[model samples]
Target chain A: MNDVRSINCTQCGAPLELHGGHRTRSLNCAYCGAVMDSHEGYKVVEQFHDTLRPHCPLHIGMQGVLKDVEFTIIGLIQYQTEEGDTWIDLQLYSPTHGYHWLSDEQGHFIFSRRVRDIPKPAHISNFKLKAPVFLGKQRFYLYEQYRAKVQYVEGELTWIAKQGNWLNITEATAPPVCLSYENSVSEEDYYKGHDAHTEKEYYYGEYFFPNDIYQRFSVEKSAQDKPEGIHMAQPYQPGLTAAMGQVGGYFFWVGLLALFVILFMNADEQPRLKYHFNQTELSTPTLIPFKVEDPQKLLEFRISVDRLTNHWVAYEMVVQKEEENVLIVEKEIEFYEGRDSDGYWSEGSREARALFKLPAAGEYSLSVLFDGGSQSTPPPLFVELYEGVVVVRYFLLLMALSLLFYMWKWFHRRSHENRRWEPVTEDEDD
Target chain B: MSTSPYPAYNCAACGGPLTLKFRYTKIITCPHCGAGLFLEDKAVKMRGLESVMADYPSLFSLYENYAYKTQKLTPIGQVRFEYAHGFWDEWWTLMSSGEACWMSVDEGDIAIEQLVTLDKMPFMPDLQVDVEIELLGESLRVTERGSAQCIALKGEIPEVIMIGDNFDYVHLSGAKGRLVTLEVQNGNLFAYEGQWIDPFEVKRL
Candidate 1:
C-alpha cells in the first residue's frame, strides 16, 4: 500500500509526495503555503502567503512502529492555546489501524486515537471539574479545558484543516490514560445533502515517555526534547529503591508470621516444679530442684505467700545450674486490701516472678529464704519454676524494622500522585 | 476466457459477456458497458447504468481473491454508497467453503458481514444513538445513524440494487469487535450481523 505518488504543487509547481490514503481531504504545501483539496484533483482551495514552519521532530512520510503497528506520519498540525502555549500533533496512518495522532507538548508525548464509544454526558459543556465521566467500564475525572487554534498546517489531513481553525478541547484523565472531547464548528461541512452540525469527537490518549518515542521512531539523540515538570497523565515509574520497599513489605508479613509461630510453640503452661516451705523452715534456706529441657527457651521462677493480708513478704533466692550460679535475685511479694467509701480496693500482688534462660539442659535449683512480714511471723512461701517461655520484645523489634521498607514505597507513590493532581487542586482553590 | 465454474451470461444492455461467481447472484453488472443487469428466470434484463467508480488504492478489487487469516475470500461484486461524510464500499464475496458474505470497507475500516433474518422487525424511528438493542442473542449499542445513497455498483449482487436510491442506515457495535448494521429501504429493513476485520490481515491472493 506504500505506493509513493508524487504531484506538483498547484500554485508553486514544486514537487510534493502523497503518502495519505483515499480518505485524505486536503494537502497543505510545505514549500509553498497553499492548501489543496485532495479530493477534487488537487485543486487549490486557499493559500497563505507567508507561514512559518513550526519546530517539530517528526516529519511527513516518516514511518514508525507504535503498539506493534507500523504507521506513517501523514500530517502535522501546530496548535496554540489562548495563553500562547503551543503543541504539535502528527497524524499517523496505518493500513490496518486507520489513523492516530502523536502529540508533543513541553517535551511530553501522548498517543491518541479517535474512539467511537461516547463518554457519558457526551458534551463537554456539561463537564465539571473533578466530576466522574464513564467511557465503557473505565471512569475518568474531568481534568482541564482549553481552546486551541491552528497555528500551522503541513502535509495531508483527513479533513480540510486550515490555519486559524480552532477546537474546544475538554480533557478527563484516569492517569496514564486520558479521554478528550473535541468540539469544532466548521463553515464548510462539504457534504451534499446534510445540515451543518457541530462536529463532536472523542479521543482516547495514553501518555508516552520521551525515551519511548525516541526509540520507537529512531529519532536522533540530539533531537530529543527534555521533559519539564510533571504531566497530568503521566503514571509514576517506580525505581529500584521503591522495589526494595515492596520486598520489605513482604518481609514484614513474614516476620509477623514467625513471631506468632514462636509465641504459639513457646506457650507451655506446665511448671517444672512447685515447692512449699513451712514457717519453721523459713528461717533456713530451702532448695527446690528442676530439670531443663530446652536451654534456648526462657525459665520462670515464681514465689508466693498465702494468707498475708495487708502485709508483705521478703525473699532471697539463688538459681544454680549444675553447681554454677546461673542467677541470683532478691524479690518481695506484697498484698494490701482495704474497704473504702467507693468499694473494696486492692494493691500490690501476692506473687512475684523472675525469668532467666539456663546455659544447659540439666538440673537447675532455686534456693529461697523468706526474710520477714508485717505479722512478725512469715506465712508459708511457695516456689514454682516454669520452662519454655517466649521473649515477645525481640519479635516486636524485628517486625518494626521490616515495616520500614513498605512505608518507603508508599511515600514515594503518594508523592508522585500528589504532584500529578497539584494543578487540579490549584484550579479548585482559585 | 470463462473458466469460472459458475454460470455465465450476456449483458442485455450492451451485449457484453457476464459471469456469475456466486450461485444466488440475481444482478450482475457488465464490466465493459457498466450496465446493471438483472437475472430473472434464467433471462438477463437491463436494470440501470452504473457509474464508473473512481480509482483508489483499496484493500480489495472486483473479482479478486484474497486471504483473510485462514479464510479465502473472492469478491464477486461491489456496491459503493455515499453517506453524509464519506463513501464506503460493500463487496459481495464468496468464501472457500462456498458461503457468501459482504465485506464493508470505509477508508481503512473493514468488516465481514452476513445477512440475517430477524423474527421481529425493529421500529426505525425509535432507534437513536447509544440505544441498546438485542439481535441474535447479542446486545449491541447504536453507534451511528445516518442515510446513504447508492452512488455506484458493479459485478454480481444477490439482491436488487438501484443507483440513486437513498436508504437509512444504523450501525450498532457490540463486545469483542461485534457489529450489526441495519438498513431500511422502501419500507423494507435488512440486517447484517458481522465482526470488524483488520485490513492488514487481508492479503491479496
Candidate 2:
C-alpha cells in the first residue's frame, strides 16, 4: 500500500516499517527497545532498558479466516485487572470491512467489533442483570458487568493508546449474539471540571464450539486447547437422540398391529376328541381310540362329570399314536369339596381333562382310568370335551413392549432439556 | 474587490494556481489535479483510495460553503476516520475570525465543536464510558469511547497530528444540544464543546 512508510530507526539505523494506517503515529521497535515516531521520521520517542515480554499466539500481520471473513491480525492488547484477571484483544482488520476485535479471556474467545445502528434502550437505568431489552427489535437479556484495564500493547493501532487504560464494561447476551457497552472516563480535562466521559455500546456475537476456533484457523495447539463452559449460544440437538424414539414409536405400534394380524390369520376352531367310560367298580382301564387332525393347532380338552356327591373322582389319560406311545397327560377330576357354606367353594373338580399338542396327526388312542371312594356313594361318571384357540394374551403383551420402548426416548429428552435450562431456574413451556 | 480572508497561492503538488476564500482552513486540495495540501505544514500529498471523498452517502460537493448562524464558514479539506461499522469525515471549516472548528455529520446528527482549553481536568486514563461526571458545572455521561485511526487527511487542522496517528477520545452528549469530546494527544488532554444543529441550519453556498 502506498500509505505505508518504510524507514529506519534514527539512532540504530535499523530498518523500520510503519503500518499503512494513517493514525499510527508511534510504535515500539522490535529490534531495539525504542518507541519511534512514525510521523517524526522514525525518531525514537522513548527508550526501554528491558526487552522481556510475554508470549502471544498471534504476531502482527498474521492472517486467518473467521466465520467466512478473512482478516489480518494487526494488533494485540494484553490487559490485566487489579484482581489479577487478564484477557487479550486481538485487533483484526479487513480492507473491505475495516476493524474487528477478538477477545481471548482465559480460554474463551469473544469476537466483536464497533458497530452503529444499535437501538438505544428506552432508559439507561434499566440496564441490569437479567433485564430484557430490545436491540433492533431482537430481544436480549443483560448478562454481566465489570471493569477492565489494559496493561500492555503491541503492533499497529488506529488510535493513541496507553498501557494502563481502563474501561467499565456491561454485556447483554442472547446466545450467539451479545451486546457490549464500554465506558471510559477520560482523565483528560478532569480536574478542570471538564471530565471527558465516553461510552461505546455495540453488539457482536457468534456461537463457537470447543474446536471451532482451532479448526477454523488451523491452529497449532488446537488439539490440546479445549473450550470449557456452557455458552448460552451453543446449538442444542436433542432431536439427534429423541428422533430415534419417535421413529421407534411409529414402528413399534405398526409391528404390534402386524403381530395381531398374523396371530389371527392362523387361528382356527377344531373339533374336540371325546370318549367316555362308565363303570361301578373300576378294574383295568379300557382304551378309547380317536382320530386326530392338525397337530400345529393348540389342543384343548374339556371334561365334565355327572351325578357325583360326597365322593371325589380322579382320572388319568394317555394318548398313544398307533404303535408309538405319546405323552401320558394325567389329570385329576375330583369332586370332594361340596358347596355348603355361605360362598360355594370347591378344592378339586370331579372331571378333568389334559391338552397335549401332538407332534403329528396319527392314530391316537386315549386310555382313561377313574378312581373313587369305596364307602361313599360313588357318582355315575360321564365325560365331554370342547376345543378352542385364541391369541388375546399375545396381542396384549406386544402392545406393552412397544409402548415401553418409546416412552424411554421421550423421558430421556425431557431430562436433557431440564439439565440445559437448569441454570435459568425459570422458563415458559420450552 | 474581495472580502475573502486569505491570500491566493499555487497548489504545491499540482502546481495549479490557487486562491483562498477563507483564512481558517489549513489544507486545500487543488481543483485541477485533486492534490490535497496541508496548508500550515505546506506539505502537499495526493489523495489515496482511503481518502476517496470528503462526504459519503451525503451529496455535499467540494464547492459547498456554509453560513453557520452569524459566522461565515467555508468547508475546506477533510479528515477521514473509520470504525468497524462505517466511516465519517471531520469537516474542517474556517470561520471569519480565522479560527478552525470541526463539524461532524453522523447519521444525520450534525454538530460543530470548537477546541476547549481547560486549566484543570480529571485524569482521563481511567475514565470509562457511560459514567457520569461533572463538567462545566453540569452533569454529563460519557457516551462513546474508542481509538480511531486517521485514514486520510485532506484539510488543514490546528493540531499537529499525522495521518495514521492514534487518538484515544471519549464522547459525551448531554441534553439541550450539549456535547463534549476528550482526546489524548501527545500524552496531553484536549477537549471540545459543541452544540447540535439541524441539517437546514447549515446553509449551502
Q: Highest DockQ among the candidates is held by which one?
A: 1
Which docking band does candidate 2 fall into? incorrect
What is the RMSD, in Å, between candidate 2 and the native fold over all Cα? Answer: 16.2
Cα deviation of A234 in candidate 1 (Å)? 1.9
| Cα lDDT for residue A411, candidate 1 | 98
Give the distance in Å from residue A37's predicted Cα in candidate 2 to where it truly belongs: 6.6
Tens digits of per-residue lDDT for model 1 on B1-205?
8876767788897787776677778888777887778998779998855577777657788878899878999998889999766788999999998788999988678889998998987888778998888877988888889999998888888988888989999988886568898999998899999988756567888
Candidate 1 lDDT at A362 equals: 81
**Over 4 Å off, model 2:** A1-56, A122-127, A187-196, A222-224, A231-430, B1-205
Best by lDDT: 1
CAPRI band of model 1? incorrect
lDDT of 2 by residue, B1-205 (tens): 3345566566767777666655544556576776656565344454333345533344233446677678777766567776543556677777677777788765345678988877677678656877888886678878778777777765445444456777788888775557888988668788899876544345655
CA displacement after TM-score superposition, residue A282 of candidate 2 (Å): 22
TM-score of 1: 0.63
lDDT of 1: 0.81
Candidate 1 error regions (>4 Å): A1-5, A48-50, A186-197, A253-287, A294-394, B1-101, B111-205
